[model samples]
Target chain A: MQFCVIGLGRFGQALAVALANKGHEVLAIDRDEQRVQEIEDRVSQTFILDSTNEKAMKSLGLSEFDWVIIAMSSDLEASILTTMIVKDAGAKRVCAKAATDLHAKILKKLGIDKVVFPEHEMGVRLAEILSSPSIFQFLELAEDYSIAEISSPREFWDKTIRETDARKRYGINIIAIKRKEPYTDEKTGNIDYREELIMAPEPSQKILQGDILVVLGHNKNISKLEKATR
Target chain B: MKQEEIEHLLEEAKFYILNNRFEEAEKYLEKLLKEHPQNIEALFYMGLLNELLNRLTEAREYYEKVIELSPNHEGALEHLSRLQGK
Candidate 1:
């Protein structure tokens, strides 16, 4: 993957360096010569150029970049202009960090859909981790829907799918179940737990204690189920 | 094994694969195949398990077996393309 990041503010620099470290080709750019120089060794290339300048923008030939991120935190005009320049020059995907709601609205009006406020996403994820039980791993699919690996509900223990009839009662589907089995590592010769998955079990399949149910449905239904199990 | 029994085995194998429990997953899958040599679902999963464990050649063979049983298996075809670096 090819990534072009304009602005070497903390957020942009971290994003660019992380991408480069992941083995993706990154071209880090900033108007400040010192910022550009500091990142030259970490990324594939670093350049000092005024992104809004027509000749400089043209020289980037943005089509070569698969993803362009405008992370100009302090400078709104520069951030917005660089976003416009990159999109106009045909960068496949453009993401920009918005400092405020009005700035985000302007980016959307300019047809950039991948506008992000990093702190907001981090906050949501942190809340999710803090609230959910250690057993369940949740992935938010949308505002209302999510997929979670939750420990089997207490009421479900020793019950068959036919008896539980979860689909009708909970409005969620148990897509799979994970169970831990004792085993020895092939290389280490030490005892360890090996988890196994059961996909789409039959209606007659029984729910056992300590089983992790991979459930997919609306977030409300999942929360209800989690409360009942707890 | 009954259909329900086979399902339980596949489920266990898939769980192991998800948790990076390859050896245990392989044990269940191998036992599954030994009992029901022509189970296409189990065959497909073995391929997936191998793919995740970075056993490319073994994964390819397992996927090919699934294709042999069910020629139009979309998962197998897609995985084969990835294995061959298409």
Candidate 2:
């Protein structure tokens, strides 16, 4: 995949480097020469040019990349203008970072393929994690539904899926189980651990102590299930 | 079943659903629908049950049936819209 990241701020730099590390061709652009120099070795290409310059942007053939991310939320005018230039150049996909609700509205009105509010999303994720102690991870699918990895409740220990009756009792479906098993190293005479994942575990499969359950359900029901841990 | 018996069965299903005994609710709803196939309440509850169980296709089918039987059914309309991502 080819990705172009504009405005080499902290977020853009991180995104570009990560994409490049993932074996994608990443082109990073910024007005600051230092920023370009900082990441020149990390990405496929680095350019120091004002993104608001339509001619310079068009010369790069923005449409050639699979995705172009405009990461300059701090400078609203430059961000908006760059987005327009990128869109006008027929970029296949455009994602922009929005600093505020009004900025997001404008980005949406401009027909941006995707708009992200990094700070707001991060805050919401942190809040969800803080409130759910039993939840190891959570991915919100909709306003009310989510998929979560939660510690197996005490009541569920040693019980088979049929016996636990999770779907009936909590209105949640356990999709997978993650467990860590101890093993002795044959040559070193030392104990080690290996992680195992059981996908779509059978109804007769038992929930063991220290097992993590990957479940999907409504948020309210998930909270109810989490409370069962106490 | 008699009217009183049907009402009692519906109440039982509703009770089970509210208490998070979805399997028991499904059993009772199945029994009710077996006798009264076109019961709107039974179909709607079945749809809700299937949705909670992650049987998306079955849920959509049940909700569609409910809408077909009664186009102005508000509950069915709302759930169907959500299921269809409308």
Candidate 3:
């Protein structure tokens, strides 16, 4: 696969590096010579070019690349113009970053369907994390399946894994347990806590208060447990 | 080759997918992909068609290909993320 990224900002650099690491050929471009220099070694190729300039942009032959990503997030005008230039240059697939909902709407209206809002997406995920404090972490697996680490619900305190019947009732498997052990520091004479993880514990493993339940299952079932614990 | 022609073929593949004609959808998508191998929509729909047929690994392959060709595609990333259980 060949990818042409038209901005070498943080997001663009990350995307280019990730794609390049995946063994894909990537052309990383930016108007800033410094930014282009920063990512020159990370991606397949680097260029300092003004993407909004139709003449210069068209010279890149964006159509030959499998994808052209317009990632000028800070400059709305430049981003929009670059999107237009790429499309007009006969690029088959183009994805662009929009600064806001209004920006996204405008991009959509222009028939660019692959507009992304990185900050907005990250904000939503952060909000989800904030709202679900008991869910220590959430990792998506395959379609409909996820593995999540969540603090055990109060109701499950002191109960065995079998007693909770999480596997039977919610169709979720408890993969591990994380417990905090308190210890007093010898030199400082202060009490601290250390996390201990038990992997694939026996069904009889006791669930103590503050124990973090590591579970794996379908998203629906995991959500049931995630919400139930809340 | 032309925009309208490619779109027409995409619609045909979409119709087959919606109608549960898995083989037909695959056939149409394969032909479209042969012409434009990096077509994002075709690869994404091919992922969907594979998912419907219970070929999850194949679905992940197609979705990952779409993401490789075009990063951060919402549907492709969402579906591909779900398959990575670890």
Candidate 4:
């Protein structure tokens, strides 16, 4: 896919690098000369011109790209203006970076294809890890829904995966397991026995102590798992 | 190796922080760091927690670490300067 990313901040630069690395054709643009130079080698092309300038966007032949991403995360005016210009310039898909809920709402209202909240998104992820230690990971699916990976609490230890009635009672589907294995000493060259759990396991699979259970369910259900296990 | 998992964790952490659940937010961040020690999101919020609790030295450490990881990290630089009595 061809991608045009505007605003060469950290987030934008990272996204461009990742996408380009994935073999996609990427055109990275920013008003800052230094920022443009930073991504020069990582992308198919680099531009130091302001994306908000319709003339500049058109001159660059942005219409040839399949997708345009406006990444001016901190500058609302620049982001909005850039989005409008990209759309007017005939980009097939336009994605924008938003700094606030209001900013996102406005961008959506303006018909930007996608609105990303990089800072807010990062903040929420770190918050989850702090709130539920038993839950190794979690993702909000919607307002009331979520998917979580939780450590098997003491109560579930030695029980078979089906015994918990996870799907029936907690509305959680066990997705996978993360197990810690014993390390071998280079001198002794000994392999020690270690515990492991079957991931996306069958109903008959057993749940052992210290096993991390990857699960998917509603937020409330996940919380119940967290409290019960912890 | 889906980025979604890491992204999801960061989102939840931010919500908890906004809700004033400092302790809860800290728990999530710690776990995240254990898995991905170099995660910028986890590092940034650890700084936030220290700053909020008035543990200026610790907060400064985290903020400085963030700048080290991403030199152009405006947020970290801004907060670190504030914490340093600048």
Question: What does the lDDT read for residue A33 in candidate 2?
Answer: 98
Model 1 Cα lDDT, one tens digit per residue, A67-103: 8888885689888888878888888888888988788
Clash count, one per candidate = 6, 0, 10, 22
Candidate 4, superposed: residue stretches over 4 Å from native: A183-198, B1-86
Each prediction's whole-model lDDT (CA):
0.79, 0.85, 0.80, 0.76
On residues B1-86, what C-alpha lDDT tens digit does candidate 1 reach at each position? 89898889988887776655665788998999998988987788788766544455678999899899999987788778877941
Structural RMSD, model 3: 26.4
Candidate 3 lDDT by residue in tens digits, A124-221: 54654566656657766654677888767766777899898888888999999887554444674322245689999899998875577899998788
TM-score for chain A in each prediction? 0.75, 0.88, 0.69, 0.90
Where does the lowest 10-residue lDDT sum fall in candidate 2 chain A? Answer: A184-193
Q: Lowest summed lDDT over 10 consecutive residues: which window, candidate 3 chain A?
A: A184-193
> Mind giving the per-residue lDDT tens digits that candidate 2 earns over A60-142?
98989999999989999999999999999999999999999999999999999999999977776667766765676788777
Which candidate's lDDT is highest? 2
Tell me the lDDT of model 1 at A63: 86
In candidate 4 chain A, where is summed lDDT lowest over 10 consecutive residues? A184-193
RMSD of each: 14.6, 19.3, 26.4, 15.3
Query: DockQ for the candidate 3 complex?
Result: 0.01
The Cα error of candidate 3 at residue A200, in Å, is 12
Per-candidate TM-scores read 0.58, 0.66, 0.53, 0.68
* Number of the top TM-score candidate: 4
Show pairs that collide, candidate 2.
Answer: none
Candidate 4: tens digits of C-alpha lDDT, residues B50-70:
554334567799988988999
